[model samples]
Target: MFLCGSYVPPQYLPWSPGSYLFLLETCLFLLFACTAAGSAGSMPSMNNQLNELRSLAAKAENRRTETGIPRVAMVQGKIPEHMLAAVYDPMINVILQGSKSMTVGDRTLRYDPATYFVMSIDLPAVGSVHPSVSGEPYLAVSLTLDPTVLSTLFADLPKPVGRVEHNLGFSVAPVTTDLMDAWVRMLRLMGDPDAIAALAPVYEREIIFRVLQGPHGWMLREIAAPDTAMARVNMAIQWIRRDFAEPIGVERLAERASMSVSAFHRHFKAVTNLSPLQYQKRVRLLQARTLMVANAKSVMAAAFEVGYESATQFSRDYARVFGLPPAQDAGRILGDTRAIRP
Candidate 1:
């Protein structure tokens, strides 16, 4: 199962004394550089924030709890090469080390510490991580974006002067010092429970504000506004997600979005990078996989549960998405000892 962040295995430990000393030196250098950059009203480079991010992520690794501060998470691990699929929520990730690649539609994006990843809507994608060989694992901090918070903040900001075209809901942008600083403060709160209750929201707001001020800020604005085209597509997406087990027609989905069939098809594909039917098929297969793993349902049962009338067709579609037939995939995920039927 995918943790909200990368899983931290027990073998990873907190930074050593030597590493702490190095981090101290790095912080000192960053302070001087940031001061110089601030005098010119320019943001400091992201290189200034990597060490602190790394140290903070290291400390919080493997220590995440359900009752911990909500909407905040840390991840650290040397993940193996594996294709995993999930519907990504609206969140921001600041990578401190290593790199990860995500495939949305036909596009593939690879990002590292110098960049921040944002998903402004729920999207399904395939992802894999590449870790360094010298024992420096992938590390990152994730903060879930709250639409209520975005709406409140968007109102106070000045309006955009020009029309912004709709793009895919996911983006990677250069990290700025202000955003990094806010993230650092948020991560630090994990160590002090008393301070978290009072301070986490303030810091989280700052992070959201900084993102709103960035290049893809308009996308967040669209997500927050209920009347926008993107928002309408999102409504249709929610409908599909809720009733994925039932057959849905494009005309009905378009009506839900208050758009013509052709327009709805275009916008849906633009936002999600998948056609309406493709999206539903993906949703069904993912749900079927969950049933196999979480409920230990047999391949035929799982297929029928997800609206598939033909077991052979279900197997073909499941294999196309997950790289394994239904039975073998179910056996692997559920750790079943019986021989998997083809």
Candidate 2:
């Protein structure tokens, strides 16, 4: 038989010291869990806000316009999750919903709900967006950065207090709550046709300001500064992006960058992680891939189009970079596409 006593208060239970410690620890853990849960819960709202922004842009613009001002576009519907091989001219891309991964050389970067990806210089790369949940699909807003405006803004701002350096044009960084809020506001402006005319530039400027103040600010600063080593390398990169078919002499590239031969070599490699010749080869190879897959250019023609003088040399380099000779890589690309299509 058990003798029942009066209810024991939590503070006066048997093994009270141990019980008290356990309760205290349990409460602490619960508190931490709740805090974490709250933070996690906020993410869905952020994604929603981004989605709303994209929706506004989509509703505002009817036809895709090609102009001197790089366009801001919103895409809808089902898009095949495939790699796009092209040069990313100066642009800021914000993902309002879904997510994407971009491959440049060996590195793969993800841009999703909480982040924005920027390409401050021209670069050839491959990019793909992941599929969405519940068929809601992905949403993205792209605003091309105006280099003239960027250069102007840099001159107006006070000189930063440190030496500038060049860096890869592409970067991924977390967008601030303030920046996200600004994006929402800008998107709202799109609904007001009158306001969009007056406000889009203002919003775009604000976005750029947020970028200049963000983690990769120094990279932007260096790119905008005309006399910096990074600026020199950027000029070389631009030349290569635009004229890959031209045989580039090291001295000639150095002259274009306004740097001495050795200085240009050091700075170009430091910024791009590749020498000028290597950079040209990379761009040319990517172009060759595009020509083969999209335009149905033969291996020899594609090679010549990208400035490869010798067919054997072209095949060797193409194989080295793409893991197959031109003919084989072209066949594989076509085969892979056919396999994926319904």
RMSD of each predicted structure: 14.6, 8.9
Candidate 1 lDDT over 84-187, as tens digits, reads 46677789977788787888767888888668899888777877766655657777778888878788888878877875667688889988888988987887
TM-score of 1: 0.81
Whose TM-score is greatest here?
1
What would the per-residue lDDT of candidate 2 be over residues 1-342, giving only the tens digit for each residue? Answer: 111223546555546698668866866787799889999988887777766776675542222223222356555444432235566677877776678787766677888766888887776666776646655556677778888878887787888887856467678898876678777877676557677767777777777888888986787788888788887788888777778899889999998888899988987766665688988888898887777777877778888889989878988897787677777666676775332111
Candidate 1 displacement at residue 59 in angstroms: 4.7
TM-score for each predicted model, relative to the true structure: 0.81, 0.74
lDDT of 2 at 305: 89
Q: Give Cα-based local distance difference scores for all models.
A: 0.78, 0.72
Error in Å for residue 49 of model 2: 2.1
Error of 1 at 20 (Å): 50
